[model samples]
Target: MTQRRTPSGQGPARRPGRTSRPTQRVRVRDTSSTRVEPRVARQARPVAAKRTAAQKGATKRTVAPRPRAITGRATVVIAVLVALVLAYTYPLRVYLAQESQIAKMKQAQDIQRRLIAEKADEVALWSDEEYVVAQARERFYYVRPGETPLIVLNDPAGAARDAGHAPAAPAADRWYDTLWSSVQAADSEPRN
Candidate 1:
């Protein structure tokens, strides 16, 4: 029987069912020629095996990195910021309200100041004797003790009648004479 030799030419051929150790490929340079070659020719793996190895390597390279979880320090920082805002909100609102109230009070004070000035001027005017006397005479129709009071009736008789007061009759007609004349006229009239 003839024995078959392996491709490396240093071992007996492997049987189809027998397991053997894997071969390592080593590169060698040919000094005579400028080309490089493998010292021992490697056996080709099956297509399915080659594809699975390639897919595993590709998945390793292309897989995305996992997202990192938030650290305790970062959480604490955010919490502190939220707490600070909550703490200051009420005080800020109160400060603004007080400022507005102060402005309103100042406005009311200015109005009061103006009123006081006007009253002061009125009081000054009343302090003068001549101004007080003039106001009293004009409003109350008062006169000095020795002064002759001449009352002028400038309005027409029609104005007096419209005001519900008829013009006075001549002073020559006494009240009794007018009354007797009226009685005689009434007696002469026919009864209705």
Candidate 2:
């Protein structure tokens, strides 16, 4: 163990610090006394590395954030979509109702056409005077020009056919077997 003592007696350590080794001091030339020592101190720990209020103030400036924008396109699109749906739905409902009504009107038109055809046939039949007279005689037992009226009971078919086709007994037929049927029918007969 040798002692390193500078001519000024100052060395690498200014004060004694604890070490795990026995004090085996070595003798070596100390370079700290040279004029280059200040640069050496600056190399070990820079002045900029230290924390200070003036140094913190030199940091880059930041701007406060502007308010975030609220996009309204999506809201407008949804509103338009709802309006379009209503527009389409209203017409669709009206079209369905109109379609059903058109079907009912067509059915009524077909019934009217059938009735017109039947009425045209009856009008043609009524144009014949013989048809008018025959119809009046059959329904009303009508006589014309003081003609004597006779009921002929001959059967081009049979007597059973005549009796079968004769005017149906009135509603009284069911009341008293045959008695009320005769009376009611006689009472309702056209006066000769």
Q: Using lDDT as the measure, which candidate wins?
A: 1
Error of 1 at 32 (Å): 63
- Give a tens-digit lDDT track for model 2, residues 60-174: 3345556556458877888999999988998999999999999999999999999999999999999999999999999898999889989886654476566676554446445
Candidate with top TM-score is 1
Question: Per-residue alpha-carbon lDDT of model 1 for 1-192, expressed as tens digits?
Answer: 444554444434554555776666966666786765677886776964876577642322233456569888989999999999999999999999999999999999999999999999999999999999999888877899998767766777878888999798867888899999999999999998
TM-score of each: 0.43, 0.34
- Candidate 2 weakest lDDT stretch, 10 residues: 36-45
Model 1 residue pairs with clashes: none
Q: Relative to the unseen true structure, what is the C-alpha lDDT of residue 55 in candidate 1, on a scale of 0 to 100?
A: 62
For candidate 1, what is the TM-score? Answer: 0.43
